[model samples]
Target: MLAPTTVPMPGLPERVRIYEVGPRDGLQNEAAVVPVAVKAELVTRLVGAGLRTVEVTSFVRPDLVPQLADAEELWAGLARSPGVRYPVLVPNVRGLDRALAAGVEEIAVFGSATESFAQRNLGRSVEESLTMFAPVVATAREHGVPVRAYLSMCFGDPWEGEVPPERVADVAARLMALGCTELSLGDTIGVATAGHVQALLDALAEVGLGVERLAVHFHDTYGQALANTLAALQRGITTVDAAAGGLGGCPFARSASGNLATEDLVWFLHGLGIDTGVDLPALVATSTWLAAHLGRPSPSRAVRALAHQPSPS
Candidate 1:
């Protein structure tokens, strides 16, 4: 088991890259459609909070994900920040076409680590999905849009009992070979443990895949996201995907919860002396705003605790 307290031997970067996915991933699963103007404002707020990489929205079919039906409008409407990189998810060639038309700079493609999940979620076998993505990735490269591939269900799958470590490593290697500049491994249902995280990392290393190009996306469904994230950090994995207000859940997967809250992750990083460049107080306020907009309480424990404390006057 990889204990969170097991610090890296030495020479790891002190700061980490936090890819904020609240505006996109977090809001997509909401029951009510957040207005496009509100979405743009949310992105602006995240940028002001010092997030350098924010996933604005996806260029998916409106019929598929009605929440992101205004993808093009959202992308065109947002106040673009010079420093932040906004990446949108593109499922296939048609999705890539929409993204290209919207002037998207960076695009993300997703595939599952298990064949069953891939078939169910993507309507294709794992190998077939990769084949389908080859042209999409190639086309994106030609257009000078960097691609980041997401390997879902890296830890566990609802259909499959336990996904093997080798399976996750194999899919990640394939995505990297397919010209994905970076790969984000997702614990889609948030059922992963610290030991499972280390085992997967060791397996990936065995296949010559370095941790630098890897990112971890964990859900707080089982209250293990932060601990798993720490395990990844201890293994030299620096990039992490978090959602503001801890908003988001898989529509297809039942009983799934939100991704690791950005506020919570920021708190963890701050305690470790790692600088994320995000304003903790401002982020807490943003989380509060989002929760109020959704008519729910803040899902982030850190944000909730901070909300109750007396503010510095």
Candidate 2:
């Protein structure tokens, strides 16, 4: 088997926790609905591949994202493994209710940095959307469930191009104030550059949200996800959000591409002599398996390169 030469990078974390979002974010944009059984199996395979945190499904309205309409059934069918964290996306109080009833251990709520995205994705203004999430976050806290808040378009917006870093920081501060435990900054359109990534992190830090409580979720639309991620890592970020096989794009934001692939991230981290606790070949095999189910070749460069390699005889 071939692998990147290990060259340690200075000032990088020794380990990174990859938050796998394939089953939810990846398949949610697919036009064809994936079976619940396949979804369950995909989650299991990702965990087996050594991904510690896997986001399984979302509790959003079924009509909105028909691909995830089987959230309850999928969660019920999963033969969850011990010591692996499975979080579900909950859009509103109603979504949170469904997740709690299904006994979800963790939940995430989606917010937007710009007013346009807030209106388009959540059907409300920025303030209105955060207002809606307050009680959801509060209720989840009351139930002892930790909530992760996703603030999309932290870099640029399709409708409102070039979001100000200060504005992103303000939205981030408010979301943190809503009793959320962690925050994932999303490059929804994949328009962020390395400098922009650093700037956003600095802005968040200025608002008292340090790198420890933050995660980076970059899309590869313009092929800058990896560079942006490196910038975040250099800034002391230890959590990254990626999808197996690069399987997801935002349904609401059509310009967005699939997320930063988990395999690719693992490859980069390993090359830098950083520990991810992921089995590279196993992660690639899992993506290859998922690509077959989706009837498309994976967009992940690492998966494509490694999945076709001849096994050592």
Q: Top model by TM-score, which number? A: 2
Model 1 over residues 1-313: C-alpha lDDT tens digits?
0112323335445898999999889998987899998899899999999999999888888887899999989988888979789999999999999899889999999899998888877999999999999999999999999999999999999888799999899888988898889999899999999999989999999998889888999999999998999899889999999999898977778757999999989888876777689888888888888788889899798888887677556
Each prediction's TM-score versus the true structure: 0.95, 0.99
Mark the regions of model 1 whose C-alpha exceeds 4 Å error after superposition.
1-12
Error of 2 at 280 (Å): 0.9
State how far residue 241 of model 1 sits from its true place (Å): 0.7
Predictions in order: lDDT: 0.88, 0.94
lDDT of 2 by residue, 1-313 (tens): 5788999989999999999999999999999989888999999999999999999999999999999999999998899999999999999989999999999999999999999999999999999999999999999999999999999999999998899999999999999999999999999999999999999999999999999999999999999999999999999999999999998989999899889999899999999999998999999999999899889899999998998898768
**At residue 63, what lDDT does model 2 achieve?**
96
Error (Å) of candidate 2 at residue 243 is 0.3
